[model samples]
Target chain A: MTLLEIMVVGVLGLAGVGMYGLLISRNLIKIVVSLQVLVKGAMLALIAAGYASGHINLAQSMAVTVIVADTVVAVIGLALAIQVRRRFGTLDVKELATLQK
Target chain B: MLNAILVVGAVVGALQAIRAKRLLVSALWLAGCSAMVSILFYAMDAREMAVIELSVGAGLVTVLFVFAISIAGEDTSDVRAFVPKPLAWLLVLISIGLLGWMIIPTIGAPIPGVEPSFSEILWQQRGLDVIVQSGLMFAGIVGLLGLLADAKVPAKETAAQKQAATSIPPPPKALSQSPAIREEAHV
Candidate 1:
């Protein structure tokens, strides 16, 4: 197996871990953070595939697209975070779930 | 040696982001993961991608996360996490299958023949996709600007906080548990 293959596998593992953390965490901030980690891992896996091919055009372009999408998600998450802070005095996802329930 | 380093760093960073209780520390770890991925990009010869990954992922996004975390405040001990055992096992099996399927086609394909023409495909067949993607990026930037335009810091104090600041105030029954609230008091 090539070094690039290992990297791709490792990145996949990292992405999985990030997703798991995000899924299980109830803290609003941690959920947001886990999401960030998820984005990072996803980007890495995609870009690693591009790199393994030794091609610049597609890989770089893919990274740009991913980053832009992530930025939008991050902004919306922040807005929600602020709203949660003001309305409930806490950002715990558990509390938010309770409130919703 | 280089790929090994990048892989290790990425693994460490991932663990840190998951485990770190402090939001700032999590952000720091997030940056580390971003940096590792950037370096991995370079190793794969996509220099342009490496630069974008570092600059955007580590620099801009990490700062954005830190800012959001600070604004959200911390009295969030009520949060909980639970994962069903059956679901986790299902995830493991699916991921393994995905790995086998994706890795095989990606690597087993002819490199020079299959991939050498990718640039032409990117420009010709995928041209519209690229343009639409760029438009999406522009829309995101504009949305972020709109958010920055309407932000108010809440006058550094709420009514409850002001009452506490002025009069005898409520006892600090939850100072340690509620740093975000204490932040309002100080502000």
Candidate 2:
């Protein structure tokens, strides 16, 4: 396989692992970690797409935008996790559902 | 060859991040993965992005995760997943397969060109996106402040309130002793 193929595989693998992590993890912090992984895969894909299209500059700019957005997501998710733990006394998503009743 | 190695390292790091028992360990693995991704970006000729990813993805984000873990507790206990493990794995595999099939055909050899400067593309072509991103950042800062302010009620205070509410109160004493009460006491 070529270098581009390798990068594509890496992107797919990372995204898959991230999704699996999100699906299986119960801890809020772990969920955040998975989300970070997922976003990294997306960033890689953006850059790769740019390289393919001979628009590296455009791609890099978009990647930068994604990075900023991702940071905001991570910060907000962490903040929400902290608040959930404080209010509910458990970090488990399953336990947090008890609040509905 | 180096790119392949870096990609493998990144994937492994991500796997470890997901599988680690402790939240802190998972966070550390995520940082390692981010570091590898930054190096990959540098190799791909996106130097500015590499630097930003190194600092923001590996550095700032990891610090944030650590801070959050410290405040929220490690949460080391093994909890059951909402979906069964086998089902989750199958779903992920199917999704990845579909994505790869759809995307692989579109990839083509990169056409060489006299590339424009990064700043030119960002400022001239993507100016609107940058402005929107700035707004998003400001909003995120404001939202984070709100969350922190809302969470400022001390845990100890809530616990104290609960204790006070649950504790039995002493019975009130009668004002001036009545004659019948005094006689009954004497008897």
Candidate 3:
């Protein structure tokens, strides 16, 4: 496989790992980490696609925007998670579900 | 060779993060994964993105995760995954198959070009996107602040609690005086 093809496969594999984490992790924080892994894979794929087309700058700008957005989202999500812990006293999603009921 | 190594390292880190029993260990693994991916971006000639990923993804995001872990308390159980390990592996295999089906056909196919230079693309062609992104970032800051604020004891509640004792009446008598409290008082 070409380098681009390899990178694409790698991206997909990384995303797959992330999907597994997202599906199987019971901790809210773990779920957030899984989402970050998934974002990393998508960012890599975006860079690879732009590199293939020789639009490195366009890809870089988009990646930068994504990074900024991801940072904001992660911070907000973490803050929310902390709030949840304070309100519910546990980070377990199952426990939180029970609390909601 | 370097690309392959980086990809493998990234994959390992991601997997380790998922399997780690402690939340802190998992977060560090995620940082490692981000670092490896940033290196891969650099290898792919996306230098600016590599830098941004290294800083924001590895640095800031890790710090945030650590803070969250500290606030939320550490992982409680060593074995609390949402699904069985075999089922998770099966899901990953299915995802890999789907990805292969989706990406294989597009390889080596020529994509249309965008002729503008970096600055031109950022400032001219994508000006609107940049503006919108900035607005979204501002909203994120506001949202974080709002969430933090809501988590605290509201200022109004504290101020009301500090009201003059003469105007508010003593606590014991006030409890007996209010109809809502009187019914619940059972005295």
Candidate 4:
């Protein structure tokens, strides 16, 4: 397989792992980890796309944007997770649904 | 060959991050994955992004995860997947297959061309994105402050305190009465 093909496969594999983790993991920290995995794949894909289109500069800039946004997301998610643990004493996502009632 | 190795390493690290039993171990695996991805970014000629990913993604984020995990504790027994294990795996596989089918055909060799430098593109063409990302960072900081400031006693502790308060006997009625009233009555 070509480099591009390998990258594409890697992207898909990473996304798949992330999605599966999101679906099955009950720990809030695990969920955030899954999100990190997914965003990494997206970053790779952006760079790969840029490389393919001969706009490496634009792609790199966009990847930087993604990095900034992703860091914020991760910070906020972990903060929320911490708050949840303090208030609820459990990290189980299922138990969080009790708030709905 | 190096590109292929980096890609494989990243995928393996991601897998380990998700599959690890301990949250701290998972976080360490995530850091490894991030580091591999940064190297991959370097291989792709996105050196600037590679540096940022290495610093923020691999370094800062891992510290934050570890801190949060330490505070939250690692009691994960109550956690259970929303869906059954087999069904979740099936769904993920199906999604990957569909996405691969749609995306793989469009990829082609990068066309060589004269392009502006990274700084020029970032400053001239994508200036707005930089400003917006800064705003997002500010918002994240404010949100974290809000979350931390809104702390409440845990439900279990609150309940326990309440029960303890109620179980305590009230002061003796005579002692509870005002001392001034007793002195006035004596006069």
Best by TM-score: 2
What DockQ does every candidate get?
Answer: 0.33, 0.66, 0.62, 0.69
For model 2, residues B35-113, the per-residue Cα lDDT tens digits are 9999988877888899999999999999999999998898898878899999999999999999999889999877777
Reference contacts preserved by each model? 0.46, 0.87, 0.74, 0.91
lDDT of 4 at B168: 69
Residue A30 lDDT in candidate 3? 86
Error of 4 at B76 (Å): 3.0
Q: Give the least accurate 10-residue stretch of model 2 chain B, judged by summed lDDT.
A: B169-178
Q: Considering only chain A, what is the TM-score of each predicted structure? A: 0.84, 0.94, 0.91, 0.95
In Å, residue A62's CA in model 2 sits off its true spot by 0.5
Lowest summed lDDT window (length 10), candidate 1 chain A: A51-60
Cα lDDT tens digits for candidate 2, A1-101: 77678889989989999999999999888898999999999999988888778787888999999999999999999999999888887888998776752
DockQ value of candidate 3: 0.62
C-alpha root-mean-square deviation, each candidate: 16.1, 10.0, 9.1, 8.4
Candidate 2 falls in which docking quality class? Answer: medium
Segments of candidate 1 deviating more than 4 angstroms:
A52-54, A98-101, B75-78, B84-97, B113-131, B145-187
Name every residue pair that clashes in candidate 1.
none
Separately for all candidates shown, the number of backbone clashes (residues 3 or more apart, or on different chains) is: 0, 0, 0, 0
Q: What are the TM-scores, per candidate, against the unseen true structure?
A: 0.73, 0.85, 0.83, 0.84
Arranged by lDDT, best first: 2, 4, 3, 1
lDDT of each: 0.72, 0.90, 0.84, 0.89
Which whole-number lDDT from 0 to 100 does residue A18 have in model 3?
89
